[model samples]
Target: MTFAPLDPVRLTADLIRCPSVTPAEGGALVLLQSVLKGAGFDCQRVDRNGIPNLFARWGEKGAAKTFGFNGHTDVVPVGDAAAWTHDPFGAEIVDGWLWGRGATDMKSGVAAFVAAAVDFVTQTPPDGAVILTITGDEEGAGRDGTRAILDWMEAQGEAMSVCLVGEPTCPDTLGDMMKIGRRGSMTGYFTAEGVQGHSAYPHRAKNPLHALVALLDRLTEWPLDGGTAHFDASTLQITTIDCGNPANNVIPARASATVNIRFNDAHTGNSLSDWLATHAEAVETETGVKIGLRCEISGESFVTPPGDFVALVADAVQAETGRRPDLSTSGGTSDARFVKNHCPVVEFGLVGRTMHQVDERVELAQIAALKAVYGRILARYFA
Candidate 1:
């Protein structure tokens, strides 16, 4: 059967038409599997925790060098769809741009890579392997997507030498930036317990709210660090503080505050948790109240330092876009954090100015340009 080469813009439009919000397949993965299977790829659909994911590979077996493209079929929920000029899932192309949710924050990126893979296989199959890792749990809790697939790959003894995550990393142009690393994120919740009594009887009750205020002040007062060479300084921000009592005359029995930190390589979740515990103990001693703290880690910071894979992508961007891409580590967390454990991973994609916003969209030209870059990187890595 003769297959027409995939067009990046058309593929992008098709993907955006799916309302594959987080935790929803919306037939996005099925569409991708059909495209890859038609190109002679061995495809597998793996479902974890009801989240649909897929893995596809082509080229000769036992190929020494494997080039992999990583991305997600999931998109964040389109808040208040009525605010969009067109249907959020309409996939409308107006004035040379495709407008829709996930058009930039990543379904478009997935399309570009798929088109690149089609170009690669049709022009010249890789000497090694070309694989795609697509997951649906990226925009949600992330418990059962990329992490699960990585474990499965290990069990099957499948290894990738290098992986590129097609997250929307570009700030301005298609090839202006490439992500080498990402900062770690941890969240902390604290509860200060005290005796409740009439506010008029100041000495009769310990005011937990007072203790909470002092604790938050200290936590946000100091800088976590000056930051490292490739990362920004660690930051802590209190997201919420709650004391349900609305009575003006009653002292609250407890006060709770939640904070989130974005940290660099200088610290780990354990180290920060330890610091929080120490501070909680100090607050307990000073305020004479029991302070309880809980910590949750979203992801640890990671960097894929300058190396052969990084150079390969850089050269490809320069060749295709005539702009030497800037290697950066600035961005929120992505599935790349999970892939970093199996292989060196970096992120590059379309401009992200519209991600997670109303009327999300991507330029038509950028879709084709990004495909060319991915195709070049594949050729250079597997040559």
Candidate 2:
């Protein structure tokens, strides 16, 4: 028996209409669950801490050669709704482009893969398994989205041999690049405290702002490294610094700053945190101001070395688009960082030039082509 092929463009439109903004289900998961469940997938609504996620599999619980696809249904907020050419949630198609918030950043990617997987299993069931882990918290704090599903998978003894994440990886065009790894991401918050006093008094009070500036200068003055083979040089960017003193003549009691680090494979979050602490301590000791440091790690750097798996994805992309995709590690972190702990994972999808922007959109042809590429990957993986 043969089932009708899934229509990714239409599915993408349906998803966009739901307005599943970050941390909200918005019926996006419900639409996906209904479709997957009807196509013989074991669907589960893995909700955690008020966030919605969906896990669906077509095979045994612990298949040895399971192929997984990860993506997010939730999208970033659509700022300045009136500034949009098309309704942010309308999912309207104009001039062969789909316009919406998640069009490229990536409700379209998810729709393509889900369509491909559903059609593949219905028409040519793979010898192994196919799992889809879709989360709703990727655009938000992300504490209980994919991580929650991973925890549930562990408790249930479910696993994947290799996974692919459908996050708009293409930089300029479809099939132009694929991510084999990602740089680690961490952020540091700094607080420096001192006594408040009149600015006219020379030595009456310590100025915390001066100490904060010195520490920030120390952190950014030196390069983290030359560069890694798969990544560029690590970077520490001072995102913000503030001294909340209203009076012009007052030396504020407290000054604060924040720095975000995108580090390569050479350092872990802990190592960088220690590095930050050392500099912070020095500033405090020299200036007689108390320094407080708080660090949060979004993800650690990870790479899936070039081999059979990388070649498999590359071959599929080249076969469909005739473009030899670059195996890159340059990008902001994704849920793949969490999945890396469970299985070797990579990311590929549509062009991301307009993701999270005011007029976010995706090319109609690329959406169809993305589905074809995903279909090819599934066919070869099972063969």
Candidate 3:
């Protein structure tokens, strides 16, 4: 018996119309769950803290070798709706392109892989398993999204041998680049306290702004490292520094600054936190200002070395698109940072030139091509 082929573009259009903005179900998962369940996949809602997520599996609970695909349904808000060429949730097709807020950022990716998975199993069922982890919290605070599903999977003794994150990794073309890893991300909040007094009487006042600047200068000027083999050199950027002093004649009692870091695997969050503390203490001692430091590490760097699995994905991409994708570790954080703990993970999808832009969109033909790439990967992985 022949099974019906899935249309990813239609699924993408349906998803775009749901308005599944972050922290809202918006019927995106409901549509996906219904489709997966109907196709014989076991579907589960692993929501946590009011955030919605879905887990679908097409084979046994703990298959020795399972393939997993992870993606997010939730999208960033459509800022300044009037600036959009098409309705942010309209999912309109114009000039061979699909226009919508999540068209490229990832509803299309989710749809493509979901379509590929369904068709692969029905047409030629793999000997192992196929799993899809779709989260609705990726565009917001990511605590309850993929993390919640993985927790549930662990409790249920479910696992995937290897996972692919369908994040938009290409920069220019459909098969230009694929991410084998990502840099870690962290932010540091620093506060400097000093006595408030007349600015003209400089000796009587300890200028917190001065201390803060010195500390920031020390951080930004010092290089974290030269660079890594698969990753780039770490960086620290001072996002904001505020003294709250309105009058030029007075020095404020406190000044605060926020510094963000995108580090390589050479440093852990704790190690970098200590580095910031050391500089803060030195500035405090040198300037006699009380300095406080706090750091938040969102994720740690990880890499899936060039090996058979990496070759499989690269070969599949090149075979379909005629572009041998560059294996890269460049990009901001993703849910793969969480999945890396469970299994070896890599990311590939369509060009992301418009992920969070005011007029986000995707090429109509690219959706079909992306599904083909995913389909080839499934065929080879299960073979």
Candidate 4:
């Protein structure tokens, strides 16, 4: 069968035209499904809880070897449309660059891999299968995005031996970096309750604000760890502190603060929760003030470690670009965190200097280069 080679840049431009904000289908997945289905791939609408997700497969299911690609079409809200020189949803090509919201955050990445997969299957027709898990909720709460697709795949006995997430992994250049793992992300919410009274009468009131500030100090002043081989030291950032009391002369009865932790393989979500709780308990014992703590773990730190699959991707990256890509876990959490649970997952793609920022764009050449790299990966993976 002869099929026209799908141009990734044109596909990316088409996707950028879709207004698929988080939690909205916005025709992005629809366009992909049409493209994939037209190319003899099996497609399914894996929408869950009203969040749109698409799952596509070529070749036999549960084959001896199945390579998968995961990406998201949903983009963060375009802030201040007037601040931009081009339409946020318009896939305008200016000076060898394609501009739009999802262009970098990852509509282009998706287009690259989709074009590669379609062309790979049509031309070479590998013995194994190819699966794509594209979600519409990566920029949102992420509850019903790839997680939901994985759940459905499990129930139906579908699986991918290894997955590559097409998130923007490079920092400065297209082939500079790739993620072998990501720091675990979790948020801790702390509330301190004490007696409320006038600020002038210090002895009459227990100030929760003071206790909360002191607790924050203990968490931030110290380092979580020196550093790991593939990961840096864990970081705890205080995102916010809230005390509703508006009166200048009153001590609030309750004050709360939130801290987020990006931890390394040295720790798990549970361990960090325990760490936060221990500090709150010590502060309570010392200050004689009641403290409440709650923690939510978005993802736990994980690494694929340098091995066979890692080499395949790194080799492909180096083959395309003259430089060897660094295998470092320096970014925030990604859908790869969830894919890690199912299979050996790695992240690789475009440079992400402007992701989620106004006038998000991708270099036209990088999009073409990324497709070639992915094409190389597929050829090597199924060789």
lDDT of each: 0.89, 0.95, 0.95, 0.95
TM-score of 3: 0.99
TM-score of each candidate structure, all chains considered together:
0.98, 0.99, 0.99, 0.99
- Which lDDT tens digits does candidate 3 get at residues 1-383? 57699999999999999999998999999999999998999999999999999999999888887999999999999999999999999999999999998999899999999999999999999999999999999999899999999999999999999999999999999999999999999999999999999978989989999999999999988699988999989988889999877888898999999999999999988899999999999999999999999899999999999998899999999999999999999989999999999999999999999999988999989999999999999999989
Candidate 4 wrongly placed segments (more than 4 Å): none
In angstroms, the error of model 1 at 42 is 0.7
Look at candidate 1 and tell me the lDDT of residue 332: 85
- Alpha-carbon deviation at 352 in model 4, angstroms: 0.3
How far out, in Å, is residue 273 in model 4? 0.6
lDDT at 250 for candidate 3?
A: 90
- Candidate 1 error regions (>4 Å): 1-3
Q: Please, what are the lDDT tens digits per residue for candidate 1 over residues 37-58?
A: 9898888887887988898888
Clashes of each: 0, 0, 0, 0
What are the C-alpha RMSDs, in order, of all predicted structures? Answer: 1.2, 0.8, 0.8, 0.8
Q: What residue runs in model 2 are displaced by over 4 Å at the alpha carbon?
A: none
- Residue runs of model 3 more than 4 Å from their true location after superposition: none
Q: Candidate 1: what lDDT? A: 0.89
